[model samples]
Target: MSNIIGIGGSIHDFASCLLIDKQMNAIEDERITRVRHAINSSNPCQPSLQYCLNWAGLQLEDIDTIIANDDLLQVIDPHVYPDIVLVNHHLTHAYSTFFTSPFEEAAILVLDGAGSKLSGTNGDIRETTTYAYGNKNDVTVINRVFGDLKGKNYVTKSETLMSNSIGEFYRAIAENLELGWLVGPGKVMGLSSYGASFGDDRFISEMMSCIKLLPEGQFKININGEKGLIDKFFQIRQNYHKKEDPFRIDAAIAHAGQVVLEKVLFHTLDYLSTKIQTKNLCLAGGVALNSLVNGKIPFLTKFKNVHVFFAPGDSGTAIGASIWGYLNNSNQTDDLIRFHSGPFLGRPYSSDEIVTALNSIGLTYTQPVDLYHQVAHLLSRGRTVAWYQGSSEFGPRALGNRSILADPRNSLMRDHINSNIKHREWFRPLAPAVLDSTTAVYFDAHCLSHWMQFVWHVRKKFHKILPSITHVDGGARVQSVSKDENPSFYTLLENFQQITGIPILLNTSFNIKGEPIVETPYEAIHAFLESQIDVLVLGEFLVVKKFDLTFKSPI
Candidate 1:
């Protein structure tokens, strides 16, 4: 009867997971504290740990173990932890996804900024892209790739050779392009689609010179670390910047970086596939969040099967570390995927609780004749609704339960949400939740992506119909929802389709710009009050705050 609690904090996306016997409860610190990435905060994971303990009906003493992914555990109070295991940072990322993957024995790919040091010291940094072979309870490393997560949170020339550190290259390019840190990659992914697909006369030469794949299947770079690559990138970008359209330069830069990243990853995966000879591949870490690169792996390599979890970054390491501890310590025979369950891993309130919350918020509410139909009707009329139902989601992306849903067909809906509610960057692409049956007809995703993890091409015909969700390059990261997985969300989509003749809904997370998705009924109501959305659905309750709505989108 070992109750394991896993904590991952510091820098960004802090989280805690409680694995009690057979059930697993996990939550991100951003959701509870209403912060963006849960960065620069004191006492980072205490509130999240407290919530996990309360939900599991256990206390500190009842817990058998707590695991952190770093030797220097970035904890609020290390004294509270009597005996916490400092698992290797990369191992946590690796086992977290591979152990929970559907594959019995798969090729594991763990690529983040810089993995933990092998010696856990000042200068000892582990490999960045680590390939492993795993079966049942044992996951063994088979190959290592070029890169480092040691210096300056990324591989710097001071620490390692300026080889194929893909994460650092992307981050640096984005920062020089004025996107700042890792925030611009998603936007650039969308932007790259709009650029010429790396023409012969394009900036591909410079990018290749900076990041080259050798004949021996190694990625090398001649550019000096840090400022050297940035200088060349800015110089090459200046050619496009001279164009009348300001976006031309930025789009070209994004396209160049994406081209280099794709080439390096393809080479790496191909090399791993040959060595491991496995049909299944498991991907984890911050770099795993790149859906564009992920979609191409199967096409370029021998691995036909690929598995990725929603929270593959630092935040997900919490659950991964806990699950790893479970497999290692208990009699469990790798049943993580079976017991993994859905991502709605937070609090689920009852109808009575919803009523009480609505009353407390001083809002006029009613349990409509059909909650799905009512919300569907609002979406049909191009009204945005904050949908907070069932339990909160565990990852950064909001699936269906906690979402701000709108009509994807509305050309203005994207701008409407941006200016009115989210206040997000113009380049922040929107996502859609389509009926699983209709996924292929609308998107050429090549596989099912219910987690909004892969970018699927919106068919030519459906492009105009789903403008709000469609990226400039005609691809969108989509969630294909089926009735069995989520009945209410599926039904809402069905009803909206019956009315608007479209089965898709623009599903952005349910929150404002600088905050995480709403986690509770009260938080949903609070977001509704702060934004200009028309409605808020908390379970069976449909609430409308008595406030004047005068703000309008400039679009």
Candidate 2:
């Protein structure tokens, strides 16, 4: 058996994964550091690499191969390691999709910022990369669009980019709005729903002038596109300021950008569909994390099926690279090995760690006779609890395993969680972990969304009761929890449902604002003790502060 480790990410969402044949163990660097997208790059740190090795129950000498998603990322040690495989940035993103997806043969599309530095003049920025066909055995690349973006000294003074990159356009929009480039499109998506749609508002459509469409579906952004959009926003700021609502202009701009993103992508998909008859698609890259845009693809385009792997952002490339390394070498790529146990691949804490942390605070706790049932009982009483169970998830999302959950019916919980708990924007919405079978009853979910990567509309009737889980636009980032995938987490939900009529919970990542999702039992306890977070559920033991309601607002 060979031990293959894959590392990915440069600027943000860094992760490492160890794949022993079909079995996989992975962890994101942010989890260990407790920073939302740690900045240290140019070399892989010991904690993350060692975590991968420890997950595989291996030593330094036990590793047989090291695979980095980007060769020029300067993260992996080239000379210190003998057997090293460096896959291209977009290629690894492609592998993450085809291999993780159920389809044996599928079309792959990748969209992101310039993943790697540009090489040619015509292909200035690599915005869209596509793998025409893929099977369990191999993926064939018929189109490569990522190597087009010119960064650094790669382009001439006159040439800014190979093509008008939707990613760069979106980046400009996000950066201009004050959300850092590293922050994904989530905040924009949240804000977009609060504004008027193009058809409903002439002002929103007027903002689309910057994006220019050319012959044969080719497009370019005028030099004035980014500046014009921002300038127009500021010019009209006085009008919005005259109004009571502070977010009026911000929401309008977000709505305009969202409209541009969705429409342009829909047109691109239609154009591509005309060229290729294949209906199955596997999508990857940072842009794939845009659930607002992703949710519309199946409906807007001719494609019948679209598969986007969990951790589609750069963090997932580590798993993709390792999978590529093993399968490419063995030539058994066609028969893709499914990464079972889901993406909760971080290191598990032993019972010893849990007990030690609990004892440190002199906190009294009791292991319930039935952990799931008792946890459900606590939730039934409207107790918001930090639940830490299995290995932490390896992405921006905190799927049940590392989540803070409360009663979905409690509408006030949203504001409470936002202002007192999460310390994020008051406008940001929460998500729901619904029973897989009952997902359609509450959401207009067309397919099974195991990961919260798709936006599903909350049913009209449930909107009033499930206000915390439902966004202002009626969309809920839905995660349909399957019993087979995570039995323990599913059981907790089942217990909660048994106690309450609703199966959904107001779920968010278990951490204070600006912190990464809690990784270790120690971190979970640390967060629990520090924040207004009501209770700490680490493994079987649940600890609560004596004066649970006595904390000051984190906001």
Candidate 3:
């Protein structure tokens, strides 16, 4: 059996993937290091690499080939390791989504803040956006856009008419707004819905004029130099913070940036539809994490079948590179590289490990006869639960395996969790974990979002009943649970349906802000105790707080 390992090494989001024959396992360094993005030295993700090896009972010497980015050779000697193959950043991103998808052929679109740096006529630039098409095992790039750095200003390369970059535009706005660098884009996306409430069109118009759709599925950002229009809005927000509408300017800027991004994506997808005959579309890179834009692609564009992998960001490049290596080494063309299983590709904790962790923490627990029934009843009665089961998910989302589940019927549940448990922005929305069979009953479209990659509008009739899960705009980042893939989560959903007449529950990542998702049983227990979670489910065992820690909302 051939063992291929893919390494995604950078200053941030370092990860490793192991493809043994057809089976695949992947994990980000952030999950093991307990850092948001695992900012580290230029090397392979050691902790993640160890985890993958331990999961499969293998060692470094056993790996037949190591596929990684060219940037990894900066710190270490290349001759010390096994046969190493270097691949480009955007090509790996393209392969991560397209190869994992069920589509035989699909148009691939990869858009990120920045990719591998290359020397240009003016200066060094990084790849920003790439369009490619994948047929069988071959992925061919059709067009590309580069983000050129001029002093402190980021812009498209000299070839494009617009000075700015489509990939970097939203990040620029987010940074100017002081939303932070690591997790700003998501906050900006969440803050967008409130922009229209202030009745301000100036920011929107100004932002729109900066971005324009170009030919050949390309778009450009043409903002002013250095401290441009985004900085102007930031200055405006400083004065607005003292007033009642503290987030008025911030919201407007976010909304404007979001509008431009969606427009560009829609235009690009339409162009791709005209170029490619297949109805399938695969999206990757950090920008693909925007569920709002991803949701609109299926309905707004000509592509009817859209596939966005679980780990579509930098973390997923490891899987992609590994797949490329695996396919190249194997002589069999009929053998397809795919995640035939699901996204729970991390190392799973055994029952003994869970028990040992509980013992070490001195936490009392009980294994109920019907664990799903008891947990579902607790949720029905308005108790927040930290559910830890099986292996951790391979993406930013916590899909059932490592999630905090709550009752969606409670209108105040969202605010309570935001302020108390998550310690995040109040405007940020929570997601819904619904039974796959009952998705059509509540949501407008019967889209099967198993990976929480799409946002669907909640049906008007169930809006009031499921207030906590639905966003302010009546849309929800939904994860439809299936019995075949996740039996425990599906059983819990079934039990929840029997208790509350709704097969839905509020779900979010099982971690507070500034930390990555909990990986080990120890981290899970620690997170449960640190927060106000009423029940902690570690496999079949249930643990609750010894004292009366009733949730009193600060809001």
Candidate 4:
């Protein structure tokens, strides 16, 4: 009954979502521009907006309403479209997770660096933490914590605004190590496990003093105290040739931060459950991306069900905006509709396009009769395959559609992929895509991490068998693949299981370090050639690259 486009994001992760009646399509601007986080504030949202429109086969005029977060005004002028509906940033985030979730009613928690400017008695404040409850179509805010950081400009203000942010606290630790804020949190998360061996507990304890945990899950930061600690122990000096070792002070700091983050999240969720009294909980915003903390929520919190969609960061705000528009303007008072069918909302490429890209690249490919079995055979033999299929996923993860697959049974596979394929820090861990039925058999958690949002412990018996996917802490970010959600990926896993008595594969994003996941066939082919990937599966056509087995050094 309605056609709406929802735009969300601030200076980074700019994205757009199109909702025509109940159907939806979304894309992130960084995927199109090939820039991580779409770093430029001046960069228009046209690319992402246009992609949604094109995917829906509609024009701008066809949309009945345009919904966007108030922060997006920095990118697009609201005056140009005077009727555009602008919603608060944290509210949009709440809408994104609660609506797509299967829960009819659930508690929503939004944690980010900062949200839209909020009214404050002292001065304007930014929202860093929010608690809300969504019942049917109605979502009501229960509580919110505002950031006290103040300045004239956005950049200067955001730094202080995030002082009370757990995500910011984690990122600050990573930035202190020169890993940068964008990808640093994950890198630090991986490095934290190494701390127990080479960590400094005194330093970690001193760092913990910078935070004061208040009642009801709120935290007040002693920024001055934290800065003094950082200046004394974390400052990098000039003429430093090599990066710090992961087993030294860096690991200790990461470990301490990781523990603190878990404590903060658990403390907050414990209080939220008391107020909402709901069996279901929904999480959004940047802080929700920490799978290690997320994995432990079910056991730690009163909530029986935890739902985190594929795209939970700022990019997901677009989906939330669209949901808000439909609920408010479509003449339905209490309609709760789930519009997502997994994270495969991006546009899909046709076989013709795949053929053309391969031809143009002057690479010979074979149209395999049974693509799944052939790829399974290669993977079982210790070959790395870049698997490209259907529409790309809409999140930071690669969910099989755009993934690098290898045998998890190979202990050396982790090192090989990190060094040769991803070109990332060795400390980073790879994830696993396992059959849905066999997930409980291999992992020790009860939550459904189908979107790879939570980390689960690998069973003790299987730890040595699946070393490539297992992290240093004996945990693996597991993606439970169901036949209904994705048949092709499921069939491939089934085939791999039949060939080798294992139902798991080491899965990582299909792109190298510092690159957005490959969007087009040409980009995929280019990445396939640039790296030491053994095989490339583009649709049904298979392209093989002759590479030496010495690189793998099979164990």
- Backbone clashes (count) for model 1: 1
**Candidate 4 lDDT tens digits, 1-555:** 688999878878988888878787888998899888888756556789989888777888888998888877766777655389999998999999988899999999998877887654433467788989988878999888766553222222224425577766777677766677878888888888777445445456666777778887687644323343234235431112245543566777778778877777777898899899888999999888889888888888898799986788888899899989988876765455666567888898999999999999899899989989999988988999999999899879999899999999998899999998889888889999999998999999776678898999999999888889988788999999989888889999999999988898889999977789999999899899999999999989899997664554254
TM-score of each: 0.90, 0.90, 0.93, 0.93
Each prediction's whole-model lDDT (CA) = 0.76, 0.74, 0.81, 0.82
Error of 3 at 21 (Å): 0.3
Preferred candidate (TM-score higher): 2 or 4: 4
Output the lDDT of residue 370, model 2: 90
TM-score sort, best first: 4, 3, 1, 2
Regions more than 4 Å wrong, model 2? 71-77, 120-128, 146-163, 197-203, 214-217, 222-245, 332-341, 547-555
Q: Name the Cα RMSD for model 2.
A: 4.1
Runs in model 4 deviating more than 4 A are 80-82, 120-124, 150-161, 196-200, 224-246, 333-335, 548-555
Separately for all candidates shown, the number of backbone clashes (residues 3 or more apart, or on different chains) is 1, 14, 0, 0
- With candidate 4 superimposed using the best TM-score fit, by how many Å does residue 338's alpha carbon deviate from the native? 2.4
Better of 2 and 3 by lDDT: 3
lDDT string for model 3 (208-295, tens) is 7666677887666654454455544555567667764667767877888788788877877778778788889999988888898888
Candidate 1: misplaced stretches above 4 Å?
71-77, 146-164, 196-201, 214-217, 221-227, 235-244, 332-338, 545-555
Model 2, 1-555: lDDT tens digits are: 878888877566677888887778888887877667767644454457778887666886788788886533555566755667777787888888888887867777777665654455343444453435676567776654442433332211222432355665566566546665667367888878887532334345665676665544455543222344444554455566577465766777777778887776665666567656778878888778888878877877777788888888888888888888877667433345555447788877888888998888778888877988887876766678899997888788888889999888877788888888877788888989999999999999878888888998899999997878888888999999999877878888999888877788778889887788888877888888777887778888877666544343221
> Ten consecutive residues with minimal summed lDDT in candidate 4?
150-159
**What digit string (tens of lDDT, one per residue) describes model 1 on residues 153-196?**
13332323223466666766676677766466666676677664
